[model samples]
Structure formats: C-alpha cells, structure tokens
Target: MDDCIIIGAGPAGLTAAIYLTRFHLSIRLFDCGSSRAALIPCTHNHAGYPAGVAGTELLRLMLEQAEKYGATREQAEVTAIVPVAGGFDVQIGDRTAKARTVLLATGVVNNRPDMDPAEHDAALQRGLLRYCPICDGYEVTDKRVGVIGTGDHGMREAIFLRGFTPDITLIAPGAAHELDDACRAKLDEAGIVHVDGPCTPIRIAGDRIAVETPAGPLTFDSIYPALGSVIRSKLAVAAGANASQDGCLEVDEHQRTSIPGLFAAGDVVKGLDQISHAMGEAGVAATTIRNLLAEQRPIRR
Candidate 1:
C-alpha cells in the first residue's frame, strides 16, 4: 500500500507530495489535469515571484519539483474511495490502489458566466477581462469597475473592489430585497452604485465592457463576477467527513479531516484560496500524515 495519495495536482497537492516524499513516504497524486489556477493569465500574489508568474508556469514548476523528490503523479479521474483495513482504496477506472492516508486537494471549479459574443471576442481574452481580485485588482486601480452578484460574498467583493477603484457598480440581477439592510448600508457607505434588476446584455468593444441595463447602456473598464465557486468535496463528504455550507471541507488546523487518515488542504478546505495558503496547509498535512503513520507501526512487545 502507498503511504499517501494526493487527490490533485494543484499547488496544494504538489506541495504535499514534496513534503511527504522528503519524509521518505511513497505518494501518488491523481488529477484530471484541469486546474482553475491554470486558467489565470498571471498571478501577482504568489510569494518569491516578485515580478509575478504565469499560472501555468507556477504549476509546471511545482509538478517538476515534486517529481524531483520521487513523487508519482497520475492523470486519472478518481471515481470513489472506500475505507479499508489499514487505509483506503481509491478507484480509478478499472483499477484500484490502497493508500494509508489520503490528502484531498481537489480544489474548486468557478462557474463561468453565460456565453456571449462579448466573452467570445478575442480582444477581451488578451487582457481586458479579468477575475480574482487578489490576482488582478491592482490592475484596475482608479478605474471604473463593475461587480456582478448580490449576496454577502458578492458584497464582500464589491467592498474589496472599492479599495482599488472609486467608481464601483454593484449589479444585482434580482430584486433589491434579496440583500440585507446591513449589507445595503455598507454599500451605501462605500458610495458604490447599485443596480437592482436584470442586466440587459454585455458586449466587449475594444478595451471597454458595454452593458445594457434598465437605465441605459453603461460601460466599464472591467467586470468582476463575484458569483462564488462550487467546491468539489463529495469524495470527502461521502466518507463521513464534515464540510462547510459552501462545501469546503472542514479540517483541523493540521488539515486533518473529520475522518481519520483523511486530510484536505488548499481551496478544498474553508479558507482563502491562495497559492501561499495552499502550500502552507500542504506542509502541515504532510507532517501530520507522517506522524500518524509512524504511530501506526506495531510495537515491539
């Protein structure tokens, strides 16, 4: 049986593999090869990369580093996991492997906005359109920005966007009643314009995003879709582990899930979805797993 199995190849999974391998434990990383981080053009907040680095480059370096330490990465979709005698059995296609410990770093998938001609336009992809305020909010400093969403999380994004740009508009596709009074007050205090109702349509022309609203066609330098992400924590949840309301796995500070021998880190756990945070959690989880395994050794009676 392998010492541990990491269920992703993102920043967290790769980092965990690096640490576990250093502890002289065998690790297998399974991933479907799609990473939300890879979709980002460039990330500025990752530590050590002062000038910033492309998401793809960071992932490549991480995987390469893990491989250097004898970590094995498999490109496969994990269908299910069943608890076994000493560990768990992971099913991939028609094959299965036993693992003494499991680290779920499956991460999350952000729901994309409805496809439109504006989104399909080539220029927007070049650099005009962006997401992840932590990644590109600085680029929109002092510029007109539009935020699309209406819940607490959406308001939080609006407040964050306000810090970067004075001209902030909150687009609520539903009735204004959906938002609480406290949230409304916060938006008012920030002097953010609120549009309560359906958005007509949006198109990207040159460097501007044109949106038709009840008032009229308004344009902004950028639009931030504050719609939250859908966490993929079913594998852990099905194993009798707890999760947050948003589906992020509930793990201890050591990144150990409710189920013993099962751990989680990165975006899969309830916390900031940042590369630095993921790496830190991975380190803790690797150490915890190593200690757990060491304790499991039979005593010399």
Candidate 2:
C-alpha cells in the first residue's frame, strides 16, 4: 500500500504531494482535471507573481514541481474511498489502490450566472465577468460594477465590492429582490444601487456587460455573480467524514478530519478559499500525515 493517496491536483493536492514526496513517502495523486483554479484567466492576488499568472500556468508549474520530486499523478477520477484495516481502498472504476492515508483537495465549483456559455466565457476572458471580489476587486477599482445575486449573500458582496468601487448595483437573479430589511439598509448605507431582477439576456458590448432588469437595461464595467459555490466534499462525506451543512469538510488545526487517516484541505475544507490558504493547509496536512505515519511505522533515511 502506498503511504498516501491525494485526490484532486489543484494547488492544495500538488503542494501536499511535494511535501510528502520530499519526506520519502510513497504517494499517488489522482486528478479528474476539473480544478476551479484552472478556470482563472489570471490571478494577481497569489504572491510571487508581480505581473500575475494564469491559473492553468500556475497549476502546470506546481504539477511539474511535484513530479520532479517523484510524485506520481494519475489522470483518472476516484470513484470512492473505503476504509480498510490498515489504510483505505481508493476505487477508480474497476481498479482499486490501497493507501495508509488519504488527502482530499477537491475544491468548490462556482454557481455561474444564467448566460450563454460562449458569451460567458468571452466575458470572463475580457474581465467583464468575475466571481470572487477578494481575488480581483482591485482590478475594478473606481469602475462601475454589477453583482448578480440577492438577499444577504448579494448584499454582503455588494458591500465588499464597495471598497473597490463606489458605483455598485445589486441585481436579483430571480423575479425580484429577496433582501431583508436589514440587508436593504446595509446596501443603502453602502450607497449600492439595488435593482429587481429576473435579470436576463446578459450581453457583452464594447468593454461593458449589460444586464436586463425589471427596472430597465443596466450596464457595468464588470459583473460579479455573488451566488455561492458547491463545495466538492462528497467523497470524504460519503466515507463518514464530518462536513458542514454546505458540504465543506470539517478539519482540525492540523487538517485532520473526524475520520482517522483521512484529511482535507483547500476549498473542500471550511476556511478561506484562497490559493495561499489552501497551500498552507496542505503543508500542515502533509506534515501531520508524515508524523502520524512515522509513529505507525518508523521512518528512516
């Protein structure tokens, strides 16, 4: 059996592989090739890249680094993880591999707006569409911004974006705004414009994105979908690991889940969804795994 099996090849999983391999542990990394980080056109928030780096490029570099250190990565989806006597059985179709420990790094999937796939991707490439304000709010500094969401989630995002831009509009995705009185007050206090939706037929024109609202057609320099994400923690949860109501796996300070020998990091865990944060968690998880395995079986050079 391998020392560990890491699911997901995002920044978190790759970081873990690098650390575990350096520790002289036998590991196998599995990736289904759907990392949310791969969708990022370019991220300026991640440190060490003053000019910024494309998500795909960053992932490529990390994967290469891990491979250089003897990390074995399989480009296959892991169907299930079953706990066994001394380890776990990782299933990939008809095949199964046994590992002493498992690390989950499956990230979350963003709930995108209802728009044409082609147009949506185009807008995203041109910076007319965005998701995480914390990642790129500075890019919209002082520019007109539109947030497609409602209720508390929408209100909070609008307020957050207010730091980067004074001109903010909150558009409901449904037929009307679901903002509570308190949410409305917060938006109003933040000087954010609220528009009733059933916002539809989002169009990209010139350097702006236009949204059709009940009030009328609205346009902005960029649009952000404040809709929440679907955390990819099902595999761990199915294996009896504790997870939050939102499906984020619950981990201790050392990234150890309730299920012994099972750990989680990145957006799959309940914490900050930043790349750096994920890598930090992976580092902690890797070290913890190394020590735990050493206690089980003596480690020697």
Candidate 3:
C-alpha cells in the first residue's frame, strides 16, 4: 500500500507528487498523457517563465522534477476509485492499488470546434487556433481575434479579450440567433460584432483562420472557443463528492473533498484553471495530507 495515489499528471498532480515524496511518503502517480496543458501553444501567465514556455516543454520539465524525487508514475488510466477500509482502491485496468489517501487532479477536456483530425491537429500545432484568453490574451494584443461560441461563456470571453484588443468578434456559427437580448446588449456595449450563421468547414492558413458563414467569410488571426470544458471528476463524483453544474468538484481550503481521505485539486476541482493556481492548490493539499498521515499511529502488538 502506498501513502498516496494521485490521478492525473498535469501541473497539479505532478507538483503534489513532488511535494509528497519529499515528506518521505510513498506515491503512485497515474497519467494517460491527455492533459490539456500540453495542447497550449505557449503560456505566459504562469510565473517564472517571463519569456513564456511551450505547454509540452513545461510538462516535460515538471515530469523530470517529479521523477527526481523518486516518484512512481503509472502510464495507465484509472477506471474507477472505490473507497476501501483504509482509504481507497484505485482501479487501473485489471489491477488495483491501495492507498492511505487519494488525490484527484484529473483536468477537464476543452470543448472545441469540429474539424478533421489531421486538420485540427495541424491548426492547433500551428497556433492558428487558441484557447484560454486569460493565458495568452497579451499575445493577441491589438490583433484580430474571434470568440467562436455563444451564451455566457462566449460573451465573457469576448469581453475578456477586449482588454487586449478591440478587434474581437463573436461567432455563433451553429446556433444562429441564439444569444438572448441581454447578451446581445452586453456584446453591443463591449463593441463586439456578432456574426450569425451555420458556418461551413473552417479554412486554416499560415497567416489566419477563416470560417465561411452565411453572412460572409470571416477571418481572424485566431479563434477562441468559449464552450467550456468537460470536467474529469467522475471518480470523485461517484464517490459522493459534490460537484457544480459544470461538473467541477468542490474542495475545501485544504483541497479536501466531502470524503475525508479523498481530496482534489487543479482543474478537477472548482477554482481558477490556471497552472499557477493549480500548483498552489497542490502545495496546500500535499502539506495538509502530510499532517493527516502524521496523526496515524501503527497498531500495537
């Protein structure tokens, strides 16, 4: 049995493993290499990278850091997490691992526009598509950008991007005229032009991205999908953890969930979905977990 079993290997899970191992706690970190962090082109909001860093490069460095502390990593997916006598039984394929504590750092999957697998891959890698305005809005400063979504998420993204540039447009390609009157007023107040149409296949070029809508062909330097993400909190939720409507888990100040030995952090738990925020949350959760384990005494013979 290990002291802790951490699910997900993004900034939160990796950071927690590093901190836990330093306390001499045995940990097994499971990851499937599907972290959204690796999809980012370059993140400048994360601290210490003044010049910014590619998401894949940042993930690699953190993996090395965790491995340096002798942290064990399992390249498998956790199918389920069942609470057991001591703590929890983590199901990874045909095997189960027992741990005195569990940390769920499974991040969310972003909602993106549909395209051919290869074309989408090329567009993302080429940095013609973007996400998380908060992470790289400055990079799009004074540049033409489009928010390809609707409802509150889309409206908020356009308003957020307004801070970086006034050349922002909101596109409701599939759901034309879906924005309510209030939302339209808000967009108008923010000076965001709304284009309605069921757009055809998106065309990506070296210099820009173009979407052929019924209104016309709209092109932009980049487009952000504000449709939100699918929170990977099924394990926690199945174990009786509370989650918001958006499926984000609820955690206390120490990142403890409704279950005592089961805790959560990072994008899996409710809060800012930033790398810095995730790391800070992991630090708090790891320290608190250390204190929790210290109170356990061995059985007397």
Q: What TM-score against the true fold does each predicted structure earn?
A: 0.92, 0.99, 0.96
Give the per-residue lDDT digits (tens) of candidate 2, residues 1-301.
Answer: 9999999999999999999999999999999999988888999999999999999999999999999999978999999999999999999999999999999999999999999999999999889999889999999999999999999989999999999999999999998799899999999898999999899999898879999887889999999999999999889989999988989999999999999999999999998899999999999999999999999999998
lDDT of 2 at 102: 98
Q: In candidate 2, what residue range of length 10 has the lowest lDDT sum?
A: 205-214
Specify the highest-TM-score model's number: 2
lDDT of 1 by residue, 1-301 (tens): 9999999999999999999988888889999998777876777777788988888899999889888989878999998878888999999989998999999999998765443754633423555556688878998899998887887877899999998999999887554525788889999999998887465466676678777767777788888777678898999898889998879999998998988899999998998888888889999999999999989973232
Best by lDDT: 2
Model 3 Cα lDDT, one tens digit per residue, 99-184: 99999999999877866678777777766788788788888899999888887778888999999999999988585757888989
Ranking by lDDT: 2, 3, 1
Estimate candidate 2's alpha-carbon lDDT, on a 0 to 1 scale.
0.94
Error of 2 at 295 (Å): 0.3
> In model 2, where do residues sit more than 4 Å from their true spots?
none
Give the poorly placed runs of model 3, Cα more than 4 Å off.
298-301
TM match of model 3 to true structure: 0.96
Clashes of each: 0, 0, 0
Position 173, candidate 3: lDDT: 50
Once model 1 is optimally superposed onto the true structure by TM-score, how far is the C-alpha of residue 240 displaced, in angstroms? 1.1
- What is the Cα-based TM-score of model 1? 0.92
What global local distance difference test value does model 1 have? 0.84
Better of 1 and 2 by lDDT: 2
Model 3: lowest-lDDT 10 consecutive positions: 292-301
